[model samples]
Target: MRNLCMKVNYDGTEYDGFQTQPNGNTIQDYLESAICSLTGERLKITGSGRTDAGVHAYGQVFNFHTESPIPIERWCLALNAWLPRDIIVTDAREVPLTFHARRMAKRKTYRYSINANRFPDIFHRRTQAHHPTKLDVQAMEQGLAHLIGTFDYTSFASRRSQKTNHVRTIYEAYMTVDHSFSRPGSDDQGIIHTYITGSGFLQHMVRIIMGTLLEVGEGKKSADDIPFILEAKNRSKAGPTAVGHALTLWSVEYEENIKKH
Candidate 1:
């Protein structure tokens, strides 16, 4: 059997999530079924990580073992021919047998986008979260800048997560306004993109951080309170959990040698 790795892109609006569930309406469910139907061999695919429902991915990675005779370069075309339009396999290559997508990843990048205009943009309703209010962006940036180091992120983690250790190292965290995405005449006025790259993330960690920053921007939470909140290690000390739709797994990065293609 050949161990194959693939980069996938998907719109997570209609599906349950990345992982398979009992109902079998997820990105993985479709990928596995399509591969089976195409190769006549049932196999399992392992993803770099799980993305919550309504979240999207621009550069998600996955690996699977297959005995099919298909060429590595053709996997993308074959899979796209069989899978739904919302999900597409962008690249594929063979990797060492020991490679495990999630375990071997060096870093992961997630971006949370907010539409803070006076009126919602109808075109981006599914991908961007609508927060139609004035925001103190400078205060939000102050809060986010404090999160760019190793610390116990328990305060920003969700109670629903089962991970015991909430400590993780954040490599980079910043915010920027995206002016490229726009309608025909109207410019992208209030599109805010908050980016966070880390070694790993706990469940709903990005969304929770976005929520905390939103509160800071709204003057509900002071920027100076961030350090105290991190030290508290209590989930209640954080702000509300933002909606999942605004979050996107932007990319997954691995060591140079690990990427065969």
Candidate 2:
């Protein structure tokens, strides 16, 4: 058997999530179906990680073992023909049989977008979280700065998570504002983009962190409160989970030696 890795991009608005479900409406389900149709074998594909319902991905990666003789370069083209328009296989490559997509992931970056205008942008309704109130960007930045370190993030994770350890190393966390997409002469301030890169993330961790920062921006919580929340280790200590539609799995990183197409 040979292991083949592929990079996938999808708009998650219409699916349950990334993982396969009994209902058979998921990104993984479509991918596996496409593969089975082309290769005539039922194969299970392993994703880097699960993205929650309505959370999109730009560079999600997955791998599967197959005995088909199909050339590696044609996988992208063949898969896209069978997959839905919203989901596309962008790149494909052959990898060592030992390469496991989830286990080999070194870092994952997620981006959360917010529309802080009085009126939501019609074009970005499905892609951005709409928050009408004015936000203190500087305060939000200060709060995010406190998350850049190894810590037990139980406070930000969902109680539903079955993972025993909540400790994860956050290598970078920051935010940026962009007005290039703003309408001419409109009073729109801009879209706020929050990015976080880490070794791994617990279920709903990024969304909860974004919600807490939103509270800081609204002066409901002080930037200094982040440390206290981190130490509390209680789920109730953190802010509400932000909407999933605004969050996107930006990219996944692995060692330099991993071949890419």
Candidate 3:
């Protein structure tokens, strides 16, 4: 069997998540079923990581082994033809037999979006988290600055995380405001985007970090309190977990060697 690597993009609104679960309406389940239908092989696909429910993906990667005689380039066309409209196989190619999507990943980037309007927009409701209050962006930036280094992020992790090692490095963490108007020159709304890139993330790490920064923005928590929160190593010391709908798996990066054949 030859290993095939694929880049997947999906709108996670209707599905449970990326991984296959007994509930059965997941991205992986659809992809695997499509592959099985096309190639007549019952193979399991390994994704780079699990994306929470309602979390979209722009460039998620996965791999599976199949003995199908179909060429690599045809895999994309073949799979997309069989898969659901929301889940698309953007690219596919052959990979080394030893390649593993999750273990070989170098970094992952996630973005959480917030709508700063008092009244939520009906069109963008599914993707953007509606926070009606005006937030102090500068204070939020101050709190984010403290997260850009290696630390034991137990405080930022969720209770759902089962990992014993909480140490993870944050390469980048920042928030930006998108000045988009409903009409020309109408400053009715602005989109707040929170981007985080790291070696890896614990369950709900990015969302919790965004929530903590929101607390700082609201004067509920001070930027200087970040290090203390980190020192606490307790989940309760952190802010509430942000809404999952606003979070998206923006991208995943693999090492150079892994990308090379």
Candidate 4:
């Protein structure tokens, strides 16, 4: 058997999530269906990680083992023909049989977008979270700075998470301003982009963090409160979970040797 990896991009507005569920509407379910149609094999595909319902992805990666003689380069083209339009396989390649997408992932980056305009942008309604009031971006930046080190993130994780260990390393966390859609002379500053890279994340971790940061931006919380919240180790101490529509699994990275033939 040969292991083939593919990079997928999807608009997750209408699906349940990435994982296959008993209810049968998910990105993985559609992918497996397409694979069965194209290669005539019923097999499982392993994703790098899961993105919650309504959370989109720009560079999600997955791998599956197949015995089909189809060339590697044709995988993307063939899969696209069977997959839905909202979901597309952008690239594909053959890897060593031992390459496991989830196990080999070294880092994952997620982006959360906020529409900080005075009025909602209809074009981005499905992809961005809307916040009408002005936000203090500098304060939000200060709040995010405290999340850059390894620590127990229980305060930012969902109480529903089953993981016993909440410790995770965050290599980088920051925010940027995007003015691509800003009007010429309006007070609108455009979108607020929050980019975070980490070893791994807990369920609803990024969204909870973004929620707290938004509180800081709105003066409901101070930037210095982040450390105290981390020490509290209580989910109630942090802010509410932000909407999933604004979040996206931006990219996943693996060690160079893992990608080598």
Over 1-261, each residue of candidate 3 has an lDDT whose tens digit, in order, gives 899889998989999999988989999999999999998998899999999888899889999988998988899989999999999988897889999999998889898988876668788788889887767888888999999999999999998789999999989988878766344554444778888999999999998999998899889999999999999999999999998888888888888866622
**Candidate 1's residue-wise lDDT over 1-261, tens digit each?**
899999998999999999999998999999999999889988889999999988999999999998998988888998999999999999898999998999999899998989877567778788889877778889999999999999999998889889988999999999888655545464345789898999999988999899999999999999999999999999999999999998889999888987622
Q: Candidate 3 or 4, higher lDDT?
A: 4
For each candidate in turn, the TM-score is 0.95, 0.97, 0.94, 0.97
Clashing pairs in 4: none
Q: 1-261, model 4: which lDDT tens digit per residue?
A: 999989999999999999999998899999999999998999999999999999999999999999999998888999999999999999898888999999899899999999998778888888899997878999999999998999999999999999999999999998889887888899986899999999999999999999999999999999999999999999999999999999999999888865422
Candidate 3: where is the Cα deviation over 4 Å? 182-189
Whichever of 2 and 3 has more TM-score, that candidate is 2
Residue-wise C-alpha lDDT for candidate 2, range 141-212, written one tens digit per residue: 999999999999999999999999999999998998988766778777689999999999999999999999
* Model 3, C-alpha of 193: deviation from truth (Å): 0.9
Evaluate all candidate structures by whole-model CA lDDT and list the values in order.
0.90, 0.93, 0.88, 0.93
**lDDT of candidate 2 vs native?**
0.93
Q: What lDDT, from 0 to 1, does candidate 3 have?
A: 0.88
Kindly report which residue stretches of model 4 are placed more than 4 angstroms away from their true locations once superposed: 259-261
Clashing pairs in 3: none
What TM-score does prediction 2 earn? 0.97
